[model samples]
Target: MSKRGSGLFFAILLAFALILSACGNNNGGGNQGGGSEGGKSSGGGDNKTLSLLTGGTGGTYYPLGGSMAQIISDETDYNANAQSSGASAENMQALKNGEADIAFSQTDIAAYALNGELMFKDNKVDNVKAIGTLYPETVQIITTKGSGINSVEDLKGKSVSVGAPGSGVNANAQQILEIHGLSFDDIKAQSLSFDESTDGIQSGSIDAAFITAGTPTAAVESLSAQKEIRVIPIADDKIKQLIEKYPYYAEDTVPKGTYKIPEDVKTVAVKAMLVVRDDMPEDDVYAITKAIFENTDKITHAKGKLIKAETALDGIGDLPLHPGAEKYFSEKGVQK
Candidate 1:
């Protein structure tokens, strides 16, 4: 039992302690780098989780976005959760600010964001890109049967709901009114949400409202069930003029049975589309696009039926499509 033996023993003990510490550090680092359970990986991996920005809970975008998110989760290695926001304009901003991975937007509003027109004027959001168009969001000029508002011109001098402030619907209402030779100044403009507008109409606080959503919109349908509603038809010439000026619009019709209207009503509509950040990987966007279109049947919303690959490019026009989405559409022979 000499000093040499004691020194050797101490050195071996220190070396063993250091080795254990290094092993524990490696294990701890691995666990920390690993993602949360049932969550997307922080490191590069096949699975990812994304946030989808949609409109308010009372609107079509919210429920439709939920369905879309579910579809992506079920069909791909991605988990998407839909979040309710202020709809088109806000959704665009979310994409621009990196707050959201994907979003729903109206074709016209998206065009404006790209070109810095109207609401987006002088503040263009160029970092967003399109996935594909979903369906037509019709501009249904709704009023009670006895409101004496059978046409757009009648809306003048009446209390009207022009949609929520800074919303795509607000922009649409403005354009439609301008085409009809009227402006917000010409009417008692009320900035209200869909539910608010309908409530105002029911309470006789507003005479009419301009709703821009897929036909059979929940708000309008609820109003129709309680009171006889009329959807004012846009005259052929005005429709022509509106389309000529705002090329995003296309001729559309609300069939007779919709809202229990007596006959068909002609109008113009913009397409609702999915948009994403420009920085998303091409393959991820492609998979998302594929999952949405290929599993439309799984979407329970009535508008789900309209989400077809054949019409994905309908009102997309010249807006830049995400390369991933473009690749998927091209493979399906659905070209822009």
Candidate 2:
């Protein structure tokens, strides 16, 4: 009954115990990873990841957003990345559907999402909130002198490139035409992207195109270099009515020297804004907003745009500022 039997029994028990411990460790590790939810631990961990939804490569959002995403990844523990999207409307929907954590959108589109108007008429996105404004998007209505189309009203019965479907430019085009007493039914409408629209103009397939972008937009610049393009003026009276009704529209003018055109063109403009989900934790949002605000100058210089942190909250339309962003701006003595 002796020492041999006792030793064998002890060895067997130890082996079984080791196997049970190993299994327990494996199960615990799996659960920990699977149970992980939400962004970086608000408790301060580097496990969180975020995605930024930007506009097409031809527009300002993609580059600016890529820079912002880099800043976020470099300045914080969370990993951030940027993705190109179909501009405002798609970006908003991305945020609502959890496809993106942050996005760049035109102020008017953000307003539409919150109020359930226009494209978002039947499906309102209530989770979006403003982070800040990046820059102004001027509504540029371009055409060559040979096109025989001069003003918004002249667009009637003419082929026009409104903008890519779901883009903020398209909405601006529709509203601009309606203000001029023209509708899609009255004009030959073309839903083309900025690059495509410019091509359309160059090919003479498009009489005029509506391009909403920052000053000196690449698409328009290329068109000007290829031909003498005129950015027709949107009369002041219509601009006034637009701003009165939408409140997001601001009167802007393409300076006389902006393009090859000889004269300045009056236009209605909207701000490009950074947005996030309203349900994002205040501290996380606060940290991100603070990082961006503090680096706004660097971002603007690198991006070559008018991105003033001080004026970020100025024309946010009906979209409420995320509490975290509001706090940072408030501390900096930026009212509202």
Candidate 3:
């Protein structure tokens, strides 16, 4: 062949090769056909990958998500990746954009997204599904005993960390203050996570900060051991209205011994749920949920979430439970 003809053939071959590679990555495993079968079951396969978007690496969500990945992998055939993200709100947005397959998010965020309320504004996140409620994220109010910060009202003029932008904790703190006629400008503000806020408290750069996490969070554990930190609970009557406007949240208590605090701390809280997009295959969702539930010991115990495997699915909303998860739950009689 002529040199020009040879060059033309080579160019065509390269283009075809690139197109083939792209198609191969997107459509997925030929094993998809054999995914769901008999009572014996098949947990998807090695080729199927699901993503779990979690909060800051220093926070509970990250470790919880990592533990989930491990437990699910051991119990199912699907490979999971627990990705570090900007927390609840960010994870919801990522879910809408298909950036992740599953995520750990606050109950308030899921409610707001589904209802198109508050931060959701015009864009409604209509496809969110809940697998289970992990545990309560207590809004921990830490203050220097000498800071004269006795209540949420006394936070005025005191340093506070609202948490990182786009995080669920920050959003909840914003709602709590606004309902009570306060604003970021009403107090000294610092954008930090539980760990960051703990560091600030240790160094005395801030007088108080809000933390939303399970009991005995490592950061709080360390801080409580050092400073004479107090757990100021959010037990205001206004919380009833907050919960009315958003039903996803409920009343929870930071028990007397959860921290070094001497008394039970009452607070408004929300469940942390593992969410998924609408399009994930039922078998895939079921297998993932099953793996996590069956290996609950691996996740909750590893991360110290203070929970049980079956307890996770206890309070799911009307949002259609993934069929696979439903199948498992139904068999276990958890959904009766």
Best by lDDT: 1
The true-versus-predicted C-alpha distance at residue 75 of model 2, in Å, is: 1.7
> Compared to the true structure, candidate 3 yields what TM-score?
0.81
Where in model 1 is the C-alpha error above 4 Å? 1-47
lDDT of 1 by residue, 1-336 (tens): 799999999999999999999997677453333233222334444556789998866678988999999988876667789998988988897888899999999999999999998888877999999999999999888899988898899998999999877789999899989998899999999998888888899999999998888888888888988999999999999999999998899999999999899899999899999999999888778878888898899998999999999999988999999988898889999987
Q: Residue 234 CA error for candidate 1 (Å)? A: 0.5
Q: Model 2, residue 143: displacement in angstroms?
A: 1.4
Please write out the lDDT profile of model 2 over residues 1-336, one tens digit for every residue: 699999999999999999999997666343232112212232333446888898877667777887888777656545789898888999999889987889989999998888998899998998889998877789989899888877888988988888777679888988888787888899899998888888889998888988888877777888888989889888889999888877888999888887667777889889888999987777778878877766665564334346666888888755799988888788888875
The RMSD of every model to the true structure, in order and in angstroms, is: 5.5, 5.7, 8.7
Candidate 3 per-residue C-alpha lDDT over 60-100 given as tens digits, one digit per residue, 9 for 90 to 100: 88888888887665655556788988888888888998889
| Candidate 2, lDDT over the whole model | 0.81
Measured against the true structure, the TM-scores of the candidates, in listed sequence, are 0.86, 0.83, 0.81
Global CA lDDT of candidate 3, please?
Answer: 0.76
Q: Please identify model 2 stretches exceeding 4 Å from their true place.
A: 1-47, 300-305
**Rank by TM-score (best first):** 1, 2, 3
